[model samples]
Target: MGTNTRRALTVAAWIVVVAIGVMLSIQRFRDAVGSDIGTDLRTFVAAAEHIRNGRSPYTEFGYVYSPLVAWLLLPFPDFDAAVGPWTAASIAALWGAVAAVTATFWRALSWWQRPVLAGVGIVTALYSALLSLDLWLGQTDTFLPLVAALAVFFASRNRQIASGVSLAFGAIIKSWPVGLGLWMFRRGVQQRGRLIAATVGTGAAFLLLALVIHGPQMFSEWIDRTLVLSEQDLVAYSVWGAGRHLFTQSAALEPLFVAPIVGTIVSWTLAAFIVALIVITLRRPGDDALSMWNIATAVVLLIPVCHLWYFVLALPLLWTWVAHALKGTRRLESLIAVAVMAVWWVIVFRLPPLDNQFGESTPQYIAVVGSSLVALTLSVVLSARRDADRAVVVREAVPA
Candidate 1:
């Protein structure tokens, strides 16, 4: 078959897979949207409503995100009835926007690659599966990925100024996306000017929006709320917390601090691996598309407090990696990434109760931490190979 025909088949197969995955998730999706999403949405609604009533939303209400994020939610009424449907629609719209933006970036690729890219997009769109949960709960995690993806996509395209702005805006809304700035800086001086412009413009825009929406006092309140949230112990809510809880209750593990410390070590190690990958990519030439996607995915995965939805950013790269891996020239590194995703899916779906009397045991920690290590190691090795290939290409193209 012609390459084009083969590519078409690949895309058709990807669409079928995505459709099935979504179909399987329908019941879970409904349950999530039907339940309370999270306190963040409630807080957002209350704050916006308070502002509409001439009360300072930031001061009287609790809000940790940037003013622009809250302002975006202001158009909807404060009542539960209004917030429910509005939040759902907003999330769905954001998901669609992110997918569209991703597609735009992939439009220039070869016909065969496009199908793989589409598969990546679909996987990215569903990476968190938690977004469906958030949708059910009427939450904003759905919009988070959209903002982050746009920021990275724009930045990679040399629209540094816009990219910076998007990054700043996303950061204001949720602090985690700021990590993209680290990736941006690591991208070097090739597009620094645009990056600076975008960062400053976006930051200024957000500040101005804050001033208009809640007056100057809003900034102080935002700072205060952020500090409070930052200090709150996450032990009971996160992977580490769940692991610790499980080990203590179920197994006879003695050192209580071991689980959290081990988890922290694993998380930071993964982060360092990602940073190294980015540094290597920066030193090489060619593979710009893959390099950009790799950096974005690594940054998202490396963040300490990553939730299930955070994985959405990794989906595009994961798809690309898998497509390349399955094409018969397997990279041990890519296979590891695939393994990590599989393990992650199992853990997320089977999460233990936060307050379950049984503590997280050594076995559970081993499973999670071991999987993370394998994934990170694979990422590093695969990234090295990718960089090596690019170097060879560049060298070969140089004049004798």
Candidate 2:
């Protein structure tokens, strides 16, 4: 294609992406700010009310977010009153994450590839269906993922302090992004310790502020709300939780409800398998992008209660795949991987959401939550071989 043709296509792609985005997002936006039930935004508003009334925010069950988030909501005393501004802020943060990450990777790309990265980012964000689901449900994990994405992106580029500070803020917001430690510490790589120490310092300082304002017991209460209570039942959006929900519970699609012991063993085994994959991948610092994507995906899927809204976290991961595939040395393999990912995402995006126990079974629920993960893993595994080949070539060229 001629340069003019290519430019035209790029312009066309942007217009198409924006048009589709507006078309798809209107109802979701309306649903979000219009007193939607089943939204975490209600819980957030209640938490804010607790704070305003001098009650502990944690006393509002399901208001298990950082005290900082509650503090942010202090102005919005009611859900109907607060949902509009909150949704706007959440969507802004969601796409702001995409734009920041695009800038980060675009800095390294050739001129032609810059447009490719932006296009990939736009498509990935829309395809994620996260905006639709998160907005509909009044979810607020959007901004935390943005911070976490920056942490992992910086960590990949060897910017330890920046990544650590981003992570500290992320932990303060929701606490799941701290799992990016796997990428920061691969094989005890140089600066791994630095990242950890930076995260500790910043996390402690920010956390201390929350403690002082919310009372020293704030830390313990945060932990219980975030982790302990969720541990008692099946988490809707996780591997183990999904397994339990699918086969062990009598809810959605549960025909053969297995014995509790059987479900326990199977769920643990799947979770352990994912742990093993992460451990093996982290054994050596390979592709920072791939590992970051996989690790973040795993953290969301494997956490004690990996809520589906958290899959919005995968927006950066998706962008990374497109960028890596288009620019990597092994074009054919990367193309194949990207193609598989694209098809899967489109299908996931179009399929009706799996709505049981509050829409936890959807495709965006972790690559629709399961097979989509395998597709992502395939992208990494295929790309890892290329990294290995390049490393070998560099070693061969070295003077002994």
Candidate 3:
């Protein structure tokens, strides 16, 4: 067959795949409406309404997000009433936008890989339960990955302020992306001060604006609500948190019996480990893509509590590995990534009998967290071995 014909066939196949995925995704969105759809967005919209009424969202609505988020949604006053339908449409539009952006980046690839990459991205966005929940809840989690992507893309072009703004906005929405901001700063020692300044300045501007809208009292109420939520026995997708679930039958897993200090110690220990992973990855020679992947995976693993949608943070990292696979750089890693992502999709979407029927959550939590931890561990170990081998080669090459 001619190359042109083969390319045409590949594109046609991708079109079919994407068309099917979109139809299925829309059905899922339709099912989600009037049934716990846009729960988080509803909370935000409710908070906005509270704010508009000269009431504190933190006190009135138990809103955990920073006050700035409510203000951001002020333009959409009708969000509360129509969050479900609006979010469904938004999710579809965002997936299309993501596919188009991903395609632009892969323009150098062969025609087949371009559509395949785009089709894969679209399918994952549309079909995965993580993203389904993200859209259904009208969650900001979907937007964070885009923010991280833009940060990396802009940093690649040496657009420091734009990158900083993206990262800062993400961090303001949720604290985790501050790690990404710091990663960008570490990439350029000379640019370090300006990067930090820009990130901090951006965050502060929003925070101050929020405070002005509310009052000094809002800070205390926000902190109280945050602390209350933290103490809740939320089933998180972290190694430590999953351990809490897996061993719930055992007395050792009972937080009530354990000292509060013990819990705090475990949290800090995991955090330190994450910091080590970030440092190891940062010291290695690689492009911004690899750095973003390393930092994002580490951050996700270390988050104290994580929902299904929180895993979206790793999407860009997975995409980077997929790109490497397309280039035949590391097919093994890519295969592992594909396998892990498949397992994750199954766990999140619950594929019928694989459901978390019991509240214990061993099946789903272990599957998702275990697969991610294994992939991350392999990446770190391989990177260390590669660096060690290079060091030995350098030593042997020195004049004797």
Estimated TM-score per prediction? 0.73, 0.85, 0.79
What TM-score does candidate 2 reach?
Answer: 0.85
Which candidate achieves the best lDDT against the true structure? 2
The stretch of ten residues in a row with the least summed lDDT in candidate 2 is 356-365
Which residue pairs overlap in candidate 2's backbone?
363-368, 366-369
Deviation in angstroms for 47 in model 1?
1.2
Q: Model 1 over residues 83-120: C-alpha lDDT tens digits? A: 55655454454445445454545645555555554554
lDDT of 3 by residue, 254-338 (tens): 2333454565566566667667777877775245655666777778777666665677777655565556567554467556766
Q: Which stretches of candidate 3 lie over 4 Å from their true place?
A: 1-21, 34-37, 75-80, 89-97, 100-104, 186-194, 248-272, 348-360, 381-400
**Candidate 3: clashing pairs of residues:** 38-136
Score each candidate by Cα lDDT.
Answer: 0.55, 0.68, 0.64
Q: Rank the candidates by lDDT, best first.
A: 2, 3, 1
Is 2 or 3 the stronger prediction by TM-score? 2
